[model samples]
Target: MTPTIPGFDYQRVQVAEGIALTTAVGGSGSPIVLLHGFPQTHLMWRDVATDLAADHTVICPDLRGYGASDKPADPDGTAYAKRTMAADIVTLARALGHERFALAGHDRGALVAFRAGLDHPTSISHLACLDVLPTLDMWQVMRGTNAAVGFHLYLMAQPSGLPEQMIAAAPDAFFGHFLDIWTHDPDAIPADIRAAYLDACRHAVPSIVADYRASARIDVDHDQADKDADNQLDMPVTVLQQDWGAALGFDARALWSAWAPKLAHTTVTCGHFMAEEAPAQITAELRKLVDR
Candidate 1:
């Protein structure tokens, strides 16, 4: 059986024409949506969502191409772009009766949340992004030997057939590599949850690759257009990230500040999967962000 957040109710909510997201919702007061990262599902937000659900409505959803969500084919390449996925999120929240709410995301989800804040500024009251730079800054900073850390990004960024075939040939190994190396605490993922993640990725190789591919192309163009227009996030924002700057030789805070004027940047000591490895810390930071 698939594991789910203990008290959360799961449902299918149509966020766009012919696309409905598998969402898990709990609690009651203010609404906040949590988007999970790559190679994982809404399950990644289990602990944090449960805790936050105490006073706030916590909505966690499998992104369009991940977990149990609908994975529409990307015939035109725009289907999986962050701009498109971000719109899905905005619609999801409105369909649930929230015109504005706090938004937070990790990894790929962070990219979506970043775009949402830019494209739907009034709809996101507050924003928090975990462990990822904006798509444009991400490409700008990754260089030389340090760029090797993002090999999967380059591999998936390739045109259609090759990346999909390469990843589909060995889905578990391809998806499992990030889960294995990026976590500081093995117990955080456990065996069952890890198996579930692997199974999800094993079944969604093509759409997942399309998501990353969009990042390399159209997503970058959108971010660049926003940058050229001097458009920035108009809401208060909180960023939590591992110290990639010291390792990659770029100031992570500076990169983030260029887009988010009202920003609080923190260098986390936990691994990249900070939400799972350090739920208490992640919860506290998110609570503070929501209050801001």
Candidate 2:
């Protein structure tokens, strides 16, 4: 069982046909769905969710093929596409009695939130993406030295069996590498929580690889189509990133402005796990979205 966030009730909600989401829900006010990132579960939102629960109903879910959620065998990348993942979240909130809600995501989840804002504009009232760029822009921005930071993206983007096979051999090290490298503080994640993450990854090799693979293939196709159509998110959007653009030689805000017209962009000093590294600040930012 996933460790329960304080004052939250856990549920395996059937959000679609044969798709059930492991969700953690708490508080009572306007709804806001929090999405977790790669190499972690909804538990990543514990501090932020509990803090926001004072005024907002926070819903955190393990995205499809992640954590304790239903992991369908989707080697083709179609099922793991952000389009499908975003639909899963939209369906989840509806099941929870929310027709429209605020949305925030970190890492992989942020990608899903990006899709949610584009595909289901009326469903999402406010959207926040932490520590990521859009899928197409992600590939465009990372080059040469900057690409080194995204080595896992290239590794996991490989053919179906290969990535999963290599990951299966040493799942702990493969996942824990990010756990160790992506954070500003080693002590930010509790030892017990780290162990849980490692243990989960050990058993989730294929599904997790499939999720990453989709990002490289089908997810990129979806994003490219959106770009070709000149599509943009028609919602109040907030972006908090670590300013990879500074080191990467690109204008992050310029890229994001193309997607989010009403954008509130800030460069956070924290690492990839900003929600954990700066929960108070993240919570305060989300509260601003709430007030807006």
- Of candidate 2, the 10-residue stretch with the lowest lDDT total is 71-80
Q: Candidate 1: how large is its RMSD?
A: 0.6
TM-score, cand. 2 vs. native:
0.98
Work out the TM-score per prediction.
0.99, 0.98
> Candidate 1 lDDT, tens digit per residue, 157-243?
998999999999989998899998999998999888999999999989999999999999999999999999999998999999998
Question: Model 2, which residues run further than 4 Å from truth?
Answer: none
Clashes of each: 0, 0
In candidate 2, what are the lDDT values of residues 1-292, reduced to their tens digit?
5467989999999977888999999999999999999899898898999999998999999999888899888845688889999999999999999999999999999999999999999999999999899999989888887698889899999887788888899888889999998888888898878887887778778888888888899888889999999999989999999977888899999999999999999989888999989999999999997687
For model 2, how big is the CA root-mean-square deviation?
1.1
Candidate 2 lDDT for residue 111 = 95
Off by over 4 Å in 1: none
